[model samples]
Target: MRKQILFLLALSLLCISFTFAQNNVQQRKIDSEFLNAVHYYENKDYDKALTGFDNVINNYPLNSKTTASYFFRIKILIGQKEFERAKDLTNYFIETYPSSRYIDEIRMLKVKLYVDDSEYFDALKEIAFLIDRTKSISYRIEAKTIGGQIAKSYLSSSDLLRLSNAFTGETVKPYLLLLLGKAFLKEGKKGDALNSFTRIIGSYPHSAEYFEAKSLIESPVSGEETSSGQALVGVLLPLKLNSAGEPTSNTAGEILDGIKYAVAKFNSGRTDKIGIVIRDTQNNEERIKQIRNEIGYNPNIKAIIGPIFSNEVRIAINDFDATGIPIISPTATDNDLTSESENFFQANPPLVIRGKIMAQYIFFVANKRLMAVLNSVDGYSPLLAATFVDEFSRLGGTIVTRQTYKSNSLSFAEQFANIAIADSVDGIYVPLAEKSDAPAILSQMVQDSMYVPLFGNQDWFFAKGFETSPELSNMLTFSSDFFIEFNSKDFQEFNNEFSNITGKDVNRNILYGYDTAKYLLTVMKNVDKNRTAIKTKMISGLTTRGYHNNISFDKHRMNRFLNIVRFKDGVFELIERFRSGSL
Candidate 1:
């Protein structure tokens, strides 16, 4: 019995030793795999590193090595731009190992990844938690620095307020408040901005933003930055602000980005910089008058760039005309705006000239001598009709006949009858504001057999079927304020540069603002930095190439260049340009 007991105990001891030995080998393998993953990560071989980390994490979920494995795997995911998987794994690790040493580090890393993914709002929320909860000093500093950037450059005013309120400590709050104050100051909210600056000054004297706050408290109103080497230009935009002080129009914001990019690009490779003092015209008469009143003889503002509407230009000239400061509107089309104020320059051609441009094209480019006009009584059609009649006649071309019908009515027998009976009609000008009205007019013109050559306004670009029918495609010619050769190298370069500068894609709203700014800045760069000098250089036919077209304000103080597009072989082609100068 004694011998049997001893043998049994020895056998049990051997089994226990064997089980412990097997477990030790499995642990060593996991440790080796994890070290290799770290080795791969250190050498920047992320794909292999990802697989190694995955092996440890999947095989040893409850093991101590799995915590570090999760961390490395998430880092690899972020490197590969696998944001969703990284985010999910991050959450799982944090929840699984709530007290893990890498928790704070991984969460901090997530904020930057979110920003890179353009998920700013989510990044901001993560930052708020770090600012409030993290005990690590480095993590808190990183959060504050990134949060300040988002608050100052990316977030709207209301968003800034929400972010400001998210931070609690006096030390952290002042940094965000200063950024918010500076942003509000730019938007012309002196009182609202002062609240933040004053708080920083009064309560947080040793804070990082304290001195800047003190300087801001004593500084003059924003946009008075005409210090020694910088030139100032005033911008009046239809950027209506909501109750929360956020701009309601994305168009206005994009335009502002383009304008700022132009300023930055101009300042590059030169010592002199151009500064802009912007005001919100709100697209309202009262707002325009208020901005003008605020801009009284502040010798800093050298020239003005915009008041996007034609009637607004009429209102703006009431003040700018007296100051002798030039105002250029990028999109206004009223024919008489330039005449209202010699100081007012129209970057877009007036409606009267859209007609005159087409007339010149029909006579000179198409080599036609006689023309007939059929137009609607309402909208710009009549104005275009009258100008085409007068200019074609002035160019020694005969008007076969001119007729008008009620706008949007399909019946055109009276007008077509007069045009059909006319002798040697070289072309017909049908100016319709409604692109939908085009098909009916074309059908009637074809039915009445009055198709000689068709001339049209810019509105016809949206009308369909003109490019589809080879007969009409070859027959039609029209004039527009601008055209973009999209595949051109210069345009593509401009687009890439604009995206790099503004963090947004280029759109037409941005293009107009960009072209106008480029034109104005190119004009201002060489001349004396004074309103009189700027005005003289602008109106003296200083033509510069633009992203879409060229800009030049001639003797009439209006941009007279029009692009003539013709459809041929089932594609619209920019065939000619009508301007006083060579391209």
Candidate 2:
């Protein structure tokens, strides 16, 4: 009986050894196939890469390399523009490996593929899933953004109505209604527009689009109230102009939409119509020069908003300086814009003032007495650092070290060594020209064991890798012209919509235009609509709270409402609402 039991144990042990050997051989095959696929992908031999990746994924589904194989296979399909096939595989991967490490990435790719294929309904379905359940805040936000574009631009009125009725996510309904209202307005369905806006104001009062919808309600009475006089405001932008005055992109249209929306809202219940005459400079300096006198001398044109490009503004301002018209560049950040033209009001403050303001905040608000400065030798960073050094020095602060380096040199060891921020350095002011370089900077700083507080410009807040490396953020404080409030996501939604339309960054240009127009037009009602009157009102400090920025132009004619923010616990927290100091 004991020999029989021993024989059974030996047989079981031999079976287990054979099973282990088979598993090892399977893992090795998967690893080898996956490696070859990676090599093929690196060499751009996508067909072979896809074949190898598919073999690993299908033949060894339980192997560790299988998930990676699926990822590579999907990537190759996407690169080959086989979005439908990529989406099918993505869905299969997600379903098969429900808890795979690559799940979220594959799902994100799935959403994009749906969007790319113009399968808006399916894309929205995927977006709805990710917005609530994804572990990625950025992915959640991007999902919301893409969803907004589908609602705002892609969806027809009937589709919007259908989706609004069918989609029961309370947070999403109001956004759809807001887009529906805009669509109605586009089609001249004013009553329908009113109804859509009213639904949001009544039902979704707490929604991110609440304030915007409330601001857009039509006049309470039947027609606009008969006001005293017509207030004409001229809009000078690169609105709907390609090379030959054709519509190249929607960025200019977005700016115009804000101004026009502000005008429409301003005229909603009021009898006095604020007329806007838009001159498309096409972002062309010569075009601005050509149209300068045409819009300049028009006696009815009271206030001028834009000619958005800084150089275009410089040219227009030079041409219109003698006209004494109030020219507000909603997006220009060039320091020379204000210096050259007294009539120019920059809603977005120039680089110099941004630096100076941050310096002021460190000295006055934070009470930091000593600081180190590190910036690139050229472009925005050095200019930012120079003004900061000037302002900090003028404000009775000591500069421990001012270090300059060549741009794009990932090796910051030498510069960090030179800063020597070991003692009495209250803060290190490192302004970066490219946000892409932030990871290298953060990594080098972490390696050097530099744990001092960092003061930087707005670019730092948007740095990609910083979210994953919050330890390197230390106690970062920065200045920005705009702040995106997740609590108020209507404009944030529009932000993404514009990005989709332009395929480029729109960085709150809509709000820049809206806030400037809203600020100026509000003043136009109080004072005479003449150029001098508008200019005086702006100079005397007319402050209006805006969506992305606060409008309170100080004596220097730059935006004084720069937001000071800090990185706390892996999130950006507003430290101060708006703060700026004198030159």
Candidate 3:
């Protein structure tokens, strides 16, 4: 009797253990499926993700994976723009998991759905409810932010009036007035728009829409006597740096002269003209701030042109962006600046793009499969070299060796000594733009008789006496966006006119200023004369043919073209031009 009882107990325990292990394995499989669905959602494979999420939901009943699958399914549906399906899933999630922690998130997503569909009234109603009730800080902020956007959209006066009546939130009112002003302007009711803008400016001076309203009131579209019927643009330059900083007055003068010439040329050709307001930033942060504030209220300045140093640009971009004023930087090439603000547009292409341009030329045009890089430690040089390295390797080209020197280093011996001039190295890339370092590297190469074709960036041509160096003159090629051929008839004529006015030879700064001003003026003519419309239009993928290159903008607002130039008999000759969107 005892043995029989023991056997029965043993059999029951074994069955229980086996059942537990099997359940564990099944749970793990469901968890894995849920994770895979998440991965698919992240990778933007909406269809597969939906199938995977549905599988988890059906197979993992009342489990954590099932709850997560429900939330993400709704999110994916929303991403795919299946609004009705998302609405259904959301309702199902609320009914199925009444105690889920993601309720706020789901509600926020619903608010986004309404806003995206331009159901502004519905969005506002939901946002007002969220702001009043939700304790989740992030959720409340998201709801209020969307409320602001809804107020900014182009809406009928009736719709605007309805929104105002529905939601009297302090944060949402200013943006509504802003949109109202723009709508009034769109109807050619400048007086009504001005009245609306004035009310906002007077009542809500610290509101988010205040800067834009002030801008519109100050620089309206009508060619009225107050606005002088012209596009008033501002130019901020570091014309006079401190004594410690190099005095680049001549460069600033040339740039200014070019802008003046372009404006004069433009005005002479057309009845609609642009006027420029020049401000010297003095290369100081405080000065830039002061000037920006002054320009911010100046009623006459519609757009801004410069503040060339990266540091100064960083200071001014946010202010200009808030005011709906477009500021174009001609020479600041820091790639990080592109993300600083929307209104900050770079007229010079970034160094990384230049590096790719060099790589493409060496790979396809020069047919050099193996290359070596000589680099310098500077803000700009290493980026150029690394970009070239990445691109060259991607093109099936080999980087035989890379060497670097400290900035302002006089000797290239140590940097160059380790580079073995292999037979495979068909070219050498010199990624320094300075006058001394580039020529020093080239001279060392010449002494060793390693006559490889040397490649350089735009700064290589900026050196004054580079052409006089016999070792540096031949097999030397660099890239730039500005190259004026004296023999070209049109250039010759422009040169004469520019010389007559400025008594100075036109240089790179001049070319950039001319190009930037001309481009802005052309855009001004096409876009609405109001500040908001002009600002939006400038960022809307506008492109134009400039003097030496085609000026188009990338999504980040960086100039999109680079011209590869070769040095021959003291002149930099344009060998090839590369556009970012093209090969």
Assess each prediction's global lDDT (C-alpha) against the native: 0.78, 0.76, 0.74
Order of candidate numbers by lDDT, starting with the best: 1, 2, 3
Q: Give the TM-score of candidate 3.
A: 0.57
lDDT of 2 at 19: 96
Better of 1 and 2 by TM-score: 1
Model 2 over residues 1-583: C-alpha lDDT tens digits? Answer: 9999999999999999999999888878778888998999999999999899888866765778878888988888899998878888998888888778787778778878987888887776676655545666556556665676776567667776776676666666776676678667666778898999899989987765665576557332112222234556878877656577565657677777677667876788987678887778877765665465355544566778887888788888876775577888888888777889788888888887888888888998889998999888867998899899999999899998888877778699987887764467888998889887777777777888887888899998778666545776747888888875655577557557655655644446567777888998888886666677677778777788877778877667888888888888777877765657566
After superposing all C-alphas onto the true structure, candidate 1 shows an RMSD in angstroms of 20.8
User: What TM-score against the true fold does each predicted structure earn?
Assistant: 0.59, 0.56, 0.57
Q: List, residue by residue over 324-398, the lDDT tens digit for candidate 1.
A: 788988889887787788888888888878787787778777888988888888888899998888888888899
Per-residue alpha-carbon lDDT of candidate 3 for residues 433-456, written as tens digits (9 for 90 to 100):
467666566666666666668888
Clash count list over all predictions: 0, 2, 1
**Order of all candidates by TM-score, from best down to worst?**
1, 3, 2
Question: Which 10 consecutive residues of model 1 have the lowest summed lDDT?
Answer: 220-229
- Cα RMSD of all models vs. native, in order, equals 20.8, 19.8, 11.3
Model 1 residue-pair collision total: 0
Q: Which stretches of candidate 1 lie over 4 Å from their true place?
A: 1-229, 242-246, 580-583
